[model samples]
Target: MFKIHEIREIIKLIDQSSIKEFELEIEGSKVTIKKSGGVVEEKVQTIVAQAPAAPVAAAPAPAAQAAPVQPAAQPAANTQVPEENLHQILSPMVGTFYSAPEPGASAFVQVGDKVTPNKVVCIVEAMKLFNEIEAEVTGEIVKVLVQDGQLVEYGQPLFLVKPE
Candidate 1:
């Protein structure tokens, strides 16, 4: 998911370049960005694969929502929502998310799976290196938020856990 900051950078790049439109497609997800009337319009569409490349869930595009642009001396509206009672396991780096250790391997955890601090919950592959991601909170996995092979940004929520 492109963060608001990333989108801003893209807009700046577009404004400084001759390109009027940009589109990127990965797997079943597509992102189309266009410039209109000094405003940037981005349409992202994603289809969740039932038998996901692995047992992972889909990546987050909706979480990339942008806040209203504000001029200098003004503050933008806060768009962040707090996940109460749910401990979130976040990605530590920008990488491709993986639910299993390797191809054809079963996933590390699923919804309803119980986990504890330091327990490996998934893998994030960065630059061909696989880094194990741990569940920091003792809890029951309530949700797996990112798909296997999905590109995830640093600090992006990967799983939601209901604390024990």
Candidate 2:
């Protein structure tokens, strides 16, 4: 029979090791442990010489349901824009925004520059990976909302574009 102290010791050992799975069997008692990446799962199983049959019962039928009715809703929400006539290009992820590819290099796109959908506008560094941001709409950049090496939030406006 495994004691509480033995189980604690085993858990400590498993925590200290990088091994993902461990099993032990002694005197008809079995223990199985598994770890996923850094998560730990402990399971214990005991086998008896004889097992009793379980009683069965009939399950009730599910209740009848009605179909849902669609409600009339507004198709679009309106946002009042300033007189600048510019559409905002928002950041898709939270990271450090960079205007240029490298230090002292010219920016990928500048204010008053025409940008196409395929044009690379900037780089955002997240989790040690440098991700290049692309312009999704073809337009002329009217304003840069963020500075180089600045920390940006998700969905924050990075650039303003004036449609051609």
Candidate 3:
């Protein structure tokens, strides 16, 4: 099931982008978001395969929600400088984010850490494949957006850097 924050983030991103419709289906669950007349609407649906021997409980389907699009607010810490000045490191795929190489290991990068374009900043595990994410900009890390082991969506901002 998709978390509320995740759904909200998806909606926010869609509102900021030019895409009018977006859909994603995973493991029989589907989420669709559409923008119309300056309003955003989202529908979430879950499908379950059932066996004849045992019946599953019937639940009411979720209804689509429409919300007015609003400009996203910048975090207090990041408001010091304009967002245009910060370089955002974005995820290339949907996956779970890992700060360290393995359990109990030190994080690859931290706030205030200087990084080069080739620096491996984190790992994103998708479908059992661990992909190393690099800091494509030469700068000092300014913010770590997502927590360790958090599920991240494609194009999500993983880190913000102040270019040197």
Model 2 residue 35 lDDT score: 43
lDDT of each: 0.60, 0.59, 0.67
Better of 1 and 3 by TM-score: 3
Question: Mind giving the per-residue lDDT tens digits that candidate 1 earns over 1-164?
Answer: 54456445444433332333445465665655544443433344631111102111333222234212112221112223355878878877556789999999999998778999988999987645789999998988877777777666556678888888
Q: On a 0 to 1 TM-score scale, where does candidate 2 land against the true structure?
A: 0.50
Candidate 3 stretches with Cα past 4 Å from truth are 1-79
Model 2 bad stretches (over 4 Å): 1-84
Off by over 4 Å in 1: 1-82
Q: On residues 53-157, what C-alpha lDDT tens digit does candidate 2 reach at each position?
A: 222232211112211111213211223445278776776655678989999999999877899988899998754568999888899887777778766645667
Q: Where's the lowest-lDDT run of ten residues in candidate 1?
A: 47-56
Pairs of colliding residues, candidate 2: none
Error of 3 at 11 (Å): 20
TM-score of every model versus the real structure: 0.51, 0.50, 0.55
Number of the candidate with higher TM-score, 1 or 2: 1
Better of 1 and 3 by lDDT: 3
- Poorest lDDT segment (10 consecutive residues) of candidate 2: 60-69
Candidate 2 scores a C-alpha RMSD against the true structure in Å of 18.4
How does model 2 fare in lDDT? 0.59
Scored against the true structure, residue 88 in model 3 reaches a CA lDDT of 88
